[model samples]
Target: INRLSSALIRTSTKCINALDALRSLKDGLDQHPSITKEEKERLLNFISVARQEYDEIAKKEIQKAFVYSYEESAKVLFDNYLDNIEAYCNSTKLKDPITDEEVSPDEKLMRSIEEQIGVSENAKKSFREEILLRLSSYARKGRKFDYTSHERLREAVEKKLFADLKDVVKITTSTKTPDAEQLKRINGVSAKLISEYDYCPVCANELLKYVGSLLNR
Candidate 1:
């Protein structure tokens, strides 16, 4: 009877230790920064399964020989749990948080066009080729415009490019020449674009001159 009692005591201790280890593992996983909410839930589910296994072992009829078997079973369960945790942690990829400040597709396209135009010796020549290429690509892709005519498509493209410019630069238009306030805004935008995008100053000036000519026409 003493031997049986001692065996029961050892088995109980082992079971308690296994449960504690499982709980500790779960707590660590819960606090991990890289572990996503879904991954954490997966880890918790495994821990719950380990707890169920331990509970079932504890409820069985106690014997001197059964104690060793229980201990061995508990060891195997906990070892497997640890191995799974290690694999999951190793396999899980941490992703950058999605931000609203990320550049939009339209902005990316505009930037590419701007870079192409700004890098050339003749801004007007570069702008004409870039615009033609874009229009040609759209035509080849069978893209339909609200207007039925090619002239309207060209007008729409110009409007879109300028509209996008307003988002990054403040440009208010009037029938007459730019007023003092308008010039100030234009200068502010020019400095900002040059600073932010490393745009060529001379090219930027030439581009603005072209835009002014278009608006006047």
Candidate 2:
């Protein structure tokens, strides 16, 4: 529907609900006198099928859970990990951002991120060193190193972030009636999708359920 709306009908698709667009198209077809009855009927039939498909999928997906895209949250975690990873590889301590205490680099955390892109335990040192070296180079060049600095690292970071959030996303999305905290979080996430991620409320909620179902499976 979204693709048809944008590419075929030239409707604004992003943040504009697909169903709404289909309905609007149906209305236009109904009113436009120049379009032949046969063509109108054929298009209307297509819209009906599309609407049914959308409805059936939405009914199934409404209960599933999802998180924001990689740019929204994953890189933030990746950068923080980068800040402490070198020390972790060096067998030293790093500061905990939340607790303001010296803590060891979490081997599990580092490996969890690296494992997503097929980094092996034996090669972990070289990966970390390469990342850190790039970080230094970026700093010297008056720039910032990020997931975009390394392709595999970006994939790893995104995959790790999605994996790490799976359980929480499942809980949040699958709940029919959330508690106060959950409701707040849901509203905040939805709002962020609308404001920052260019999703309309309809698509945003639909996306949450879609990802939620994927995680459950």
Candidate 3:
């Protein structure tokens, strides 16, 4: 049961991290072509704050959910992508800071999907496939691969993941763990990120969006 719980938590964290990546991408798009110097500075400010908020959220989520071995392994990949994103966002700001009026929720989400997933056409498809892959791993058990039972288990798994995720954010202040060596290995290759970006950009982006939407539960 403890292992199961940890697996579920890791699954949830992956979903959240993926979603946040997409969200960051969307924010970049929505704020593109800063209209003025002031706008650019404002954009930078907003991004800094958003990045801080995102980092904080990720730390809490990961610490609480990744108590199991599988989760810890999975997070190495997630952290690598996040590290890249952090670099990307910072680079963008250094290039040209800008802020615009609020963007629509849908547009924001779309851009997020694009950035976290990828700007390339094939990269996006790979992202969706990765999500499915992780979902499969999370939902898998060592028993005889029972489809009916698997489906039911997935539903329950999702439910528990969300419940704990929400509780951690609401009831606790923060949760963070250090595993620098593990992170180094996971981020070193970006195996998971590459797997997700293996599909066509258009299809992959759509798939990520669809999967992220389901995470609302």
Index of the highest-TM-score prediction? 2
lDDT of model 1 at residue 62? 15
The C-alpha lDDT values of all candidates are 0.43, 0.71, 0.38
In model 1, pairs of residues that clash are: none
Q: Over the stretch 1-217, how does candidate 1's per-residue lDDT look in tens digits?
A: 3333333365434322344466567656745799888988988899899987755442221111122223343344333322332333344332323753422223233333334224343453344354455545777889742221344333333333434343322233222467776666556545644665454565445434434444444
Worst 10 residues of 2 by lDDT: 61-70
Ranking by lDDT: 2, 1, 3
TM-score of 3: 0.22
How does each model score on TM-score? 0.22, 0.54, 0.22
Best by lDDT: 2
The clash number for model 2 is 2
Model 2 Cα shift for residue 165 (angstroms):
2.3
Pairs that clash in candidate 2? 64-212, 65-212
lDDT of 3 by residue, 1-217 (tens): 3333333365434333333454454455454564676776676677667766655554433332332223443344333333333334334322212455432223232234344323455554444344445545656754432211334323333333334444432322221342664444223223322353343333333333343333433
